[model samples]
Target: GTPDAEEPTVTAWGLEGSSLRPGQPSPALEDWEEASEWTSWFNVDHPGGDGDFESLAAIRFYYGPARVCPRPLALEARTTDWALPSDVGERVHLNPTRVFWCLNREQPRGRSCSNYHVRFRCPLEATWGSWGPWGPCSGSCGPGRRLRRRRCPSPAGDACPGRPSEAQKCVRPRCPGCGPNTCGCPDHILLGSVVTPSGHPLPGARVSLRDWPGTVATSDAHGTFRMPGVCASSRANVSAQMDGFSAGMAQAQANSSMSAVATVVLNKLEKPYLVKHPESRVREAGQNVTFCCKASGTPMPKKYSWFHNGTLLDRRTHRYGAHLELHGLRPDQAGTYHCKAWNDAGAVRSGTARLTVLAPGQPACDPRPQEHLIKLPDDCGQPGRGPTYLDVGLCPDTLCPSPAGSSPRCGDAGSRCCSVSRLESRKVHCSGYTLPVKIVAECGCQKCLPLRGLIRGRVVAADSSEPLRFARILLGREPIGFTSYQGDFTLEVAPSTQRLVMTFVDPSGQFVDTVRVLPFDPRGAGVYHEVKAMRKKAPIILDARQSNTISLGEMGEEAPLAAGIIPPGAFRSADGQPYTGAVEAQV
Candidate 1:
């Protein structure tokens, strides 16, 4: 054959060329040609006996004079084995009548020779495989689909008999309430509708409940949705959301059947600001006080904090509504108070307010008076000075010493002011000096009188200032009189050359004190001479007259002589009534 010539037509015959089979020839090749000189390709009719042609053995084709034919070309026929072309893709249709021609050119003993033959085998039967494990259900709660799959053996069976994977309805157990076993769950229903502001139904809105978080219902064309099998008497939250609207919520308690409806609307955002600021106040000490702060905003304030003097107060201690309350208020708690209100937009501070705590007992008063006025008169000498004769400065005998080289007074330092008759110490006051000093008989004074006169006086216990009621009084060796309930006693003695002794015994028969009145009183009228007594257990004398202040309730700081000096019809009471008689006289 010429180079690149088309393949020749092929015909098949029975053994020994006995007879030509019907349609034994294949379609003639048109543009196809041999790939190379040593190889060629051709199609065969059936070479096996059956018309189905299960196998092929040999291929014989008449060729032109060979340029290099093998020396011993074998004529034996067997199945031909060819290297399948890599470029031939999978699942391709193979021609039953085609044959592979593989030729080899080799020289043995200096002769180039080649041998070839064609062969065929019966197509292997396809083996089917067992089914695989079932796949997961396509749906969780309803009738759904599952699939199982298998595959025919690779390379040997290129085609499968049927579908590789088969799908069927999943065999799931009945649901608690919605399925065949309705008694497994409570028979409850949830029904609701979503709507616009105008009450028109809004379709395709999503409604969900917290109790069934994983489940949701979509509104139908009528904006109505229904869910069954919810637990009875349980609480749940229902919410609705859609595009171009804010989410709306409604609380639902599941019963035999629950019906909840909600409408959603959104508004523009706003910032928080104060509406009413807190006010200041003054309260009496130990009283309770309260303050309030109110505000306005789009979303209400979520929290509040109270402040005292610009410091944040503990939230747990006060009540809400921005209310700051203080109980048992005291002077120490007086300070500036304010409140802070907070919301999603921001926080705002209120105007500062003040809290003043007034003191107890006294009417709110000012500080003490500064200007001096003529002091009020009293039996205690002067109102401001206190209640005793020594405070009024009545000691006339003790005078200031004369200038150097001048005459000296009776109570002067070197003058004989004290005699043996006036033996005890005495306090001497000088003209130019403010303080006085004690002097004894050892200090000489030219003229010092003896303390010789009658003694009559009231007696009182110095520490308590209470009267030593019914006490025994003694003069020398004789008992004079017992002190009355008023702690008063009187005694008289002949002018004594020796110092006179005065003694007292308490009503309880307790020995009180003994004192020489001669040293205390020079003229000794003893009218203003009040005597003090001491307990014998500790026999120390304490002068009751040394105390400067005495308390008189309604007559506070008023002189006892003022009661007698009032003119007729000139008196007035505290309420400004005219000419009042004495209280006992009026009664």
Candidate 2:
């Protein structure tokens, strides 16, 4: 069979130049040449005999130019040859320029041959022919390495591929970081990547991050937040809530380093409501009063109504506003008032207020008068001029009729009849009445009236017959006059009368004696005298000069004059002088 095409193979090898400086490592090589045949000592026909390699030497050989070398050589190969081929070369020569070596051996004719018939194969191995300052090397190296390439340093200044240093991978935060107990951002905000429980980014959700002692922050649209100048030692707590979403919370530690992201979720909640009334009580008699109803609910009250006395009042009065104003009050309006507030959920009523009203003026009679009677003075003994008895009577008018069957009569006596008479005489029956009578005597030509009388007399003491000074002489019930130094008294009578009774009374109101008299005398210029009878125990008046002249006309008895009494200015018996004897008296 023709030679099978060489199986595809790859090899890695390195070569050093001869001119390389001391302590300098060589670079890795890129290319190589393939060997056709080789001979090995163990497979030789003579043991340990030098064989001729003329066929290998006479074969066409591709070679590279020689150059100065630095360190050593290394080669790595892979082949598809199943059994060793017989046409391989015995020895190989390395070339610096081409990065490959040629194999050579001696032939049987004791001369170099270009070809060999037996297969001789050897396993590939790297070769190092030189040494560097640190160690032997076969390829180029990275910066900061020893010429021998024994040890390499990492960017972090440690052994290559070891643990990183603090300057290499350790990172801290410029601002406050989040933690389990505090919000990483200022004003309780969440920072960095965050998600809800359902793994959706919460946009426009009010997320709050809080630190201890009431510091808080909010999250932005990116679900990231930061807090400036926050306490690094405080714990971070994050929360989020939105409409139609469940509320959620998360916690983190606020260390100087970066914090982990927190997740939040929100749930639904209920709202509270209230119904209130402003007034407490109402009065009877309905008044135009106002009622205020205040309602607070998640959804506000939609309707309001007022009730009075268990009946619904006019709905228009409640202005669909805060307060209800009622105009025009009435008595029927008095009742308990209350308000009701209603919404979609339900209705509520306020407490009742009681109301009241009042009523308006109403008529009445006069008082009666009492009856009384009074007596008039006895001195009023005249026919028409003297006072009359007071006939007390009850009349609507003071000018009403009297008891004497006359107009303007006494008010008390009504129509009763009465009578009056002379002093000390029997009372005569008359159609009208007179008051009690008072008697008086007149001394001059004028006849004496009972109350309006003028009487003249000389008053003397009964025992000594001497004129009394300042002696009081009373006529009837009234004191008429007083006695002068001459013991004389002149008094006017109240009424006109003929037969009179007189009494001598002293200042002490003592009565000496009562003498009756007629004022007119029929005799001519002869004084008539009347005397009181003297008692035996009283002194006898024997001296005629001491005797007082008492007029006999004032006497009460109807008696004849004494025998020698004469009338003044009349012929007495046949003599020319007036008569000194008793004259013929006319009846």
CA displacement after TM-score superposition, residue 172 of candidate 1 (Å): 16
In the range 1-587, model 1's lDDT, one tens digit per residue, is 12122322122211111122222222122311321122233234332321122112222211211211222111112223332211111111122233322211211233221122332222333556899999998755544678999978856435866889998755344355533221124456666667765566667778876434333788777676775644343444667766545456665554344332334332223566775576665556776667777766645675888877775665544554566667677675678888888876678888887776767653232222223233222432434556333321112233121122322221222322212222234443333333343322222223434445565678887656678888777654457789888887665533222345577778674445646453334365553457776544322322222322222222335654322222354443422245334322110
Stretches of model 1 off by over 4 angstroms after superposition: 1-175, 178-207, 214-237, 240-247, 251-262, 265-270, 319-321, 361-587
lDDT of each: 0.47, 0.37
Model 2 regions lying over 4 Å from their true place: 1-275, 278-287, 317-320, 360-587
| Tens digits of lDDT, candidate 2, 246-313 | 55676645433443444554433323133345343222233245556665543456577777666565
TM-score of each: 0.25, 0.17
Model 1 global lDDT (CA atoms, 0 to 1): 0.47
TM accuracy, model 2: 0.17
Error of 2 at 364 (Å): 24
